[model samples]
Target: MILTRAEELCRERGVQFTALRREVLEAVAASEPPPGAYDIAERLSRPGRRVAPVSVYRALDFLMELGLVHRIASRNAFVPCAHAHGIGENVVFLICRTCGGIDETTSPEVESGLGKTLKRAGFTPAHSILEVEGDCGACRDKARGAG
Candidate 1:
């Protein structure tokens, strides 16, 4: 994940960064996969930051609302939002069951299709997340016992 020019963003939003918040954001930025609250707590503890799980969770909530994060529902984890400023477009996530890898993509076709279906059903989508599960190549190879 790439961070914005910190000075620029902070200036724009009048946002102040605390040490713990910075650490948490950096950890999330550096995570190979999206991290759950527990995962974040563990990492924070390892660094001797002494940040509590609840605190980390609260920080995550703030970051998400700030448009700096995205949650992967299937994994119950959070990832840095690719779009830093824009409210994210609806995304479809391909999640790997074995290795926990995730790939996010957008599909207007899917959005319109689902919207039309929901409209017909007398429902409107205020929010949506479409997650597809499968084994990633590495995990598939691991199960097959191939080096």
Candidate 2:
């Protein structure tokens, strides 16, 4: 379903979703805690063929431009975005420190408040990404049970 949506968006934007880009997205979506560009390049490389880091970075750029993926700046990793919310909306990545899990969500109230603040400061943000690090619900529950 995610791939299908990506394909549709590319078609709508009159851009080709090339094979390498598809492969890159597939690798990102398959991994947990996301994967860095070098990790993706290594995974895509085989015995006879080699995928360069630059090539992977280029593919990541394309994916990110189309809102098909996101960069977790602190981790230097890339994650596939399902485009669950409106385009250009703020993305909040709930990163679980204990389990290395990530859940993506969006908030209109947050966007509204930030937009007002940015407007007052005459600052425009290209993209807003909030990464909150902590233990997720499941991890907290597990700890409680163990205790």
Candidate 3:
């Protein structure tokens, strides 16, 4: 679904979704945890041929521009975003410290309130993805059981 949507978006925007971009997106989607550019490059490398980090970074940049993937700055990794968000939408990434997992959700209230506040302060924001770090439900439950 994501691949199809990405392709459609690329066509609509007059952008070329190259084979390398598709492969990079596939690798990111398949990862359990988000993967870094170097990690992805290493994974895609063949026996004799090596995938360059610069190439992976370029692919990542393109995917991010199209909103097919997002960068988790804290972890220095990229994750395939399942949701198709619009402009100025607020996406919150719930990052689990214990299990190293990430879950994404959106809040209209947050967007509305933040938008109002930023407006009042005469501030214009470039990006809106928020990352909150904590232990996830399964990890918390497991820790309690162990306790």
Candidate 4:
């Protein structure tokens, strides 16, 4: 379903979703904790085929442009967007500092408040990405157990 959505988006944008792009996107989606370009390239490499770092970076750029993937700046890694076609919506990522886990969510109230504030400040936002770094519930529970 994700791949199909990506294909549809590419068609709508008049961009070709080449095989390398698809593979790179798949590699990003398959990772639990978003991965960097080098990690993606390493994953794509196999017994007979080798995926170059440059190719992965190029594909990542294309996927990000299409809103099929998002780069977590703090982690320098890329993760697949949950709502790929809903690019207009604001996304917030909750990143677990201890376990490197990420939870993606959206809240209209948050977006509205931020939008209003930005508008008042004469700032026209291109994209809004909120990343909160903290310990996840499981990590907290594990800490409690160990203590």
Candidate 5:
């Protein structure tokens, strides 16, 4: 699960991370594509078991603080961050429009490059998206074949 490290973190921080929290974390990590809160709530609510939307949302918020997950503002969805426990300023996600795939990569070079521009403008940057939308390799190949 993505929350393996998060669980360890909870232990270190003396926070009570519950089984429901782990379930919610795993639900996101297990999705072929990242799942929205509604989707996750539906999954958890199937048949005999259930978790409310508020419960799911609360768990998601807690997970976000722990850096176990990331919310995609463009899609209104969430996914497990690649570096669940890594020590970095912020992780950037490159989202693919065609295939709905997400690639998580760090950019020290980008940080330095953009940092220079921000400093020049006298504006200090705190957070950024760095999300680019484009066709992934598989989708590009498919498009080539179709054409």
Candidate 6:
């Protein structure tokens, strides 16, 4: 389903979903706690086939542009969007500092509030990446147990 959505998006945008791009997207989606470009390259590499850092970076850039993936700036990693249709400007990333977990969420009220604030400031926002870092439920539970 994700691959099909990616292909559909590429067709709609008149872009080519090359093999490398597809591989990169799959790598990112399969990652447990997201993965950096170098990590993606390493994961895709095998005995006969070698994936380069530059190639992975290029693929990541393309995937990000197409909204098939998102770069978590705080962690310097890329993760697949929960919504294949693409993440909109109002998306939020909840990052767990304890275990490196990430959850993508969106709130309509937050989006409307941000839009109003931007409008008032006379700023035309191109993209909004709101990342909230904290401990996830399991991590918190572990902390409590340790305490």
List per-prediction Cα lDDT, in the order shown. Answer: 0.75, 0.88, 0.89, 0.88, 0.82, 0.87
* Candidate with the greatest TM-score versus the true structure: 3
Summarize candidate 6's per-residue lDDT along 34-140 as a digit string, tens digits.
88889999999999999999999888888888777888988898988877544455688999988898998888898899889999999998888899999889999
Q: Which candidate number maximizes lDDT?
A: 3
Candidate number that wins on lDDT, 1 or 6: 6
Candidate 4 segments exceeding 4 Å error? none
C-alpha root-mean-square deviation, each candidate:
2.9, 1.5, 1.4, 1.8, 1.9, 1.8
lDDT of 3 by residue, 70-104 (tens): 89988998988869887345688889998888888
Tens-place lDDT per residue, model 1, 54-109, is 99988787677666777887779877765544564687777888777776667889
Model 1 earns a TM-score of 0.80
lDDT of 3 at 18: 93
Clashes of 4: 0
- Would you list the rank order by lDDT, best first? 3, 4, 2, 6, 5, 1
Q: How big is the positional error of residue 31 in model 1, measured in Å on the Cα after superposition?
A: 2.2
- Which 10 successive residues of model 2 have the least lDDT summed? 82-91
Could you estimate the TM-score for every candidate?
A: 0.80, 0.91, 0.92, 0.88, 0.88, 0.88
- Angstrom error at residue 126, model 5: 2.8
Using TM-score as the yardstick, the better of models 2 and 5 is: 2
Clashing pairs for predicted structure model 2, backbone only: none
* lDDT agreement of model 1 with the native: 0.75
In candidate 3, how many Å is residue 145 off? 2.2
Reference-based lDDT, residue 16, model 3 = 96
Model 2 per-residue lDDT tens digits across residues 7-78: 988999999999999999999999886889999999999999999999999999998888889899878888
User: What would the per-residue lDDT of candidate 4 be over residues 2-116, giving only the tens digit for each residue?
Assistant: 8999998888889999999999999888997788999999999999999999999999888887788888988899999887546656888989999898888888889889989
C-alpha lDDT (0 to 100) for residue 122 of candidate 3: 100
Q: Model 4 TM-score?
A: 0.88
**What lDDT score goes with residue 116 in model 1?**
89
Q: Write the per-residue lDDT of candidate 5 for residues 1-147, one digit (tens) a residue.
A: 456687788998898899889889999988867889989998888778778989999999988887788888888889888874454365668787887888787878888888889999999776777676677788889999999
